[model samples]
Target: MKPLTVIGFLGSTLDASKFGPSRWSKWRPSVALTMHEDLRVDRFVMLHGTPHARLAEYIAEDIASISPETTVDRRVLDLVDPWDFEEVYGKLLDFARAYPFDPDAEDYLIHITTGTHVAQICLFLLTEAHYLPGRLLQTQPAKRGEDGGAPGRWTSIDLDLSRYDSIATRFAAASAESTSFLKSGIDTKNAPFNRLIDEIEQVAVRSRAPVLLIGPTGAGKSQLARRIYELKKLKHQVQGPFVEVNCATLKGDGAMSALFGHKKGAFTGAAADRPGLLRTADTGMLFLDEIGELGLDEQAMILRAIEDKRFLPVGADKEVSSDFQLIAGTNRDLGRAVAEGRFRDDLYARLNLWTFALPGLAERREDIEPNLDYELDRFAEREGTRVTFNKEARERYLAFATSLDAIWAGNFRDLAASVTRMATFSPKGRIDSDCVASEIARLTRLWASDTKGDDDGLDPLLGDVALAALDPFDRVQLAHVVATCRRSRSLSEAGRALFAASRARRTSSNDADRLRKYLTRFGLEWGQVSG
Candidate 1:
């Protein structure tokens, strides 16, 4: 085994005594630490100020007399205020850095029984951070009725808490709780999404840097941002309120004024001094939802504010300051926007440090079941009435929801709305198969309408005359096929979905090939249709 080395401060009051044999009567932590028979401390590094030099020498000599094998190295660490955490910690850190720590050949222990409370705390922190690279040794005076003349009791605490199963379990449980909190208590099963939440939870707790959330509308970016803020607040990381801003709603001068505050009479509608969203979020969190919608000018100002925590209010000469943690949410492709000159590249780079892409509801089909229950619970809380689906209805809804045909265009918003409608229409608060069927039909029609209304299914690619030339039957069938292809990730996936019922009936089913030929019939390629 390696030689044991103990490092500690000499307690000026406790370690000090008369130079004769009377000093050995009382229990002094520093002196008692060396006299323990089981410890076998090979070296003792005693730290003290100039005033305690004589006392330190006396203790070291006395310790040497008790333990002839134990070598004492007295170090003078002069401190103006021993209780000042910064000065004491800095001095100890410097000593730790300068010291030759040979853990391979020397076992180290930091004696915490000596020094001020601040010094002890600094020692613990240093040891925990592995700067000291040792276990903590805490010595206590022996209680009454015990051998008062003998050395006091001592305990060694290993800084590696993972070695203790109970402590490790508690830490793991706390981490899991944090991740669950980030997910808003939803037992999300999607591996990628769960991993993303875990990463976000870590970043939310450990960092104050800007976090950029990229996802489609209603993919829970806003909700996740709020949850992050709440978690931070719970951890006492922030004291101020969460201030959320929909950047899409702010336009031109209004965007500038709203984000950076405004002086009274700064603009046409500015009748009073506005504190702005940034100011409102001071010492807390600022969630800029739809941040990509902000214009170049506003983006530039935001970048400055994020970097400096200072920005000029509208019509104000001097800049105001607001220190806030930023969580930006956007559906737009910021990388493309930067390349197209719509977004500032510098700002993109800054926010890109911790970018998380949240998968849409359709992408996280496995998580739909859990979120379904979550939405129902949320509905109950909102409506003050509990509603549940019949077992068959629940299974049927889950099947349909997880199927590719169910295009969750609006993501969770659509899911929540569908549930709310079903619950509101369900007789006696129990949704039956009929209710599920109606909701499925309603959602299908709604998604179909959105897809068709936005882009007249093959109208953009094929002009009016080409679409008009087709038969009504062919037009309807082709339109639906094209829509499915556009929504699908690949030709094979689209083919599997389009021919879900019939693919198994065929002996050698080539779904992608079948889809390719079908598209070719209308002189349409997969690339053209899918794009």
Candidate 2:
């Protein structure tokens, strides 16, 4: 709700000729100016009407992500029109006086966008007379061409802001930090999350820190870690597969065996010698999911493995060392758990050295739309449905989502489930309020009935929603196998149930390939989400 950050992208849209008719249309000139990447305007105050709303909407929608802080405002100060001279002059003076810039000079960024020559002249005059705080308007080209029978044909020029006025004094920091990992690094150095990403991005490139991504499950902590991995991949020392380890499955002695390779007869279950996860992840990133669940004994062993880069197998006498980057994940708070004698204090400290905490969906409500848009695109591509939610639907959905309590224990997972359900059931092309409401109501009734039903009848299963699409040409079917996996939430168990039912449907190597592809897109392994 802060004031818009003004950035001047000022230029001219009129390219009328001296003698005959206008050499080219001003309509197209204005049109092109609207699409300029750096032109940060929120409310496009139209100078003229013919090149109307559709132009404003496109520019606002397109650059909305880039200029997160600017408000693109437009106003047509008609000088030659029938209105009296003083009336026009008074309005201009008032507008220049009331322009929503911070009282202190340093807070605003003036980006003057291209329009009429008169408009640029007016802005220059106003700024020069101290009516506006910043510099003069910058006039940019309306058209690009090789020659109009001259050495070079140029339509516009970069007029300095000093043409109108100039000022000096700068002590304060920015409204937000300019440092970012993405194209607009504004958010990367703002507040809480800023320090985390900045340090991570910097140290990740320079030093080697066994990154431990700790956050509530489904907070996109892993995704952030992956981003860091990608960023590091840009550096010289990093390369190879980002191997993953689920310590939840590596229980007791089994955990030891999985982490450190075992010789044949290392244990009763060790029918064959095998390399541990650490080795399999050699010279790469080894992601350990649910690190909090690791037992005390296992924690001590992992500390050893980390310190020495070596570990003794469950039954093997010799030691094997691994050279791999370790990245740990967990939903539980190891700090609190450590104080209470659950997670090991030492392990927690080592992992905490460089950490990133992803704010949950309900925590950072501003990000809901962006995340939803991303998820919608992802699900649409996967489902093969050209589904799009209209503004009304998105607004309502976001409002409802942002209003939720912190108990959205599942976070993005829950939102995704809701979206996938809506897309699957909502009539062919669009999603609306009816769709959102109906899904919620149907689930409510189902839950009510399930809880209240008598033992006399079979307990009804929950509303298990799954989205699947098919590519008939390849004879490949993308099925979430919703029916068989009705009772499961885990991806692996669901996949197991799916495979059990899949055999009854059809047996094909192609189906397995399709399934693998689906798993990759979902970021799930056969063991994670199946049954």
Candidate 3:
């Protein structure tokens, strides 16, 4: 076996126990290094501040006497304040970088019992970063009656906590709590959605890759992106502002200038130089909502920006660079757009690396109550007054919200608006049964008008013969699917959106095939529905 090497700080006052009258006393950590049989310290690199140098020498002499085979190398490291994190961390990092590490010949360990908390933390950071490659050797005071009540006991702690079952369990719990935090306290009942959020949390923390959120409008893509940005900000991963833009709102030269900046005399309204959204997103995140609506020219520029981190501004000779994480949100079927020669295929391939499809409010009906409470809480905060639903009113509202007939086409946005209106119109800061009834009536009317006078566009699409042949339930489901497909850029996109729940449970995800089969049952084809 390779000899064990230890790198550590000499305990200034603590190491003096070696010279005490009692030779068998186990108070000092340095003297305890030779207590183990199988574990032997071949070489010790002792680091000490100016005042601790003498103590270090004395400890080194004692170590040499106790273990004649062990080599001792002592060095004086002056730290103004061992408690100051930055100063100690920088000095230790510099030392580690300069140290000759021979991994093939010796197994290294960091003795953490001799330093201040700050120094210990720095050592941990360096080891975890592999700047100093080694496990940690922490010396702890032995429990009473344990090993004859000895003072110092050496324990090795690996950086990967999976070696300890208890630590791993605690870490997993902490991770789950963090994932829940990212979801804004909405403990969703949908298992798949929860798992997706968990995966997203891991990805957001670990990578700087571009994330694509594909879901229908008001499905919380934009909100989730902002939450991710907040999480990263809390971790200090990103420092710049979160820049957001709706691509559908941009047009022509304005779109180019807004996204990629402009030269002083670039266009008609170019009064001064402008540093675009991409530049504004430096060291941060850029959220492009309705990304599918961007023109081909803009799409190509965005692709280049995402891939190379550089893009040419409108009418500029030089290309500007912005290092930013991209989070693109779209309700359109990008695959169909690619097939139809709208969205670039190369860009689709790049963005598809980490694509997550969000389910709408209708699909996650079980989570309606929690989301309702959340919306109410948000409403109270925004309006600067607390407004709550009475027990009966809340239950009634939840039931109505999650019902099959209530088509939440606008999803969370609509839900927020409903809560806002009800709270604003409520009496004495409480929503009673009458208030819920009125809100329900208002929503029903709004939805009825939205679907074009309650027929829901079914009559026109089905025709009399086809409409009469199918059962009412099948007709409703089929009509909804047809509407989704018509709005979708491709059949697969529509299928994924429509059968999101079914696809979650399916081991083999052939969404397009399943959708095609369902459409055929209704005497429908991709061409007919798309047209």
Tell me the tens digit of each residue's lDDT in model 3 across 119-182: 8877876675445768889887677667733345778987742111121100001123433767
User: Cα deviation of 472 in candidate 1 (Å)?
Assistant: 11
lDDT of 2 by residue, 1-531 (tens): 323234332222232223223432333333333344544334433343333444445444433544444455655444454234344435555565446544232333233444444444544444443344443323344336522211111122323322211322111222235555521223322255555666667767776767777677777766666666666676646676777766778776777777777899976878998987877876777788889888888888788777778887777778888776777888887888998998998888888887766666545555566556556655644543324565577666766665422224466776677778887665343577788677656545543464353231111211123222323332122232432232343445444545655666765535445555665663445444332
Query: What TM-score quantifies how close candidate 1 is to the native fold?
Result: 0.60
TM-scores, all candidates, are 0.60, 0.48, 0.56
Candidate 3: where are CA atoms >4 Å away?
1-179, 453-531
Lowest summed lDDT window (length 10), candidate 2: 456-465
Candidate 1, residues 402-509, lDDT tens digits: the string is: 988888999999999999899778634568899999999999999878877465467777788888899979987888888788667799999998998898887889
C-alpha lDDT values of all predictions? 0.85, 0.54, 0.80
Backbone clashes under 3 angstroms, per model: 0, 38, 0
Q: Model 2, residue 165: displacement in angstroms?
A: 60
Q: Rank the candidates by lDDT, best first.
A: 1, 3, 2
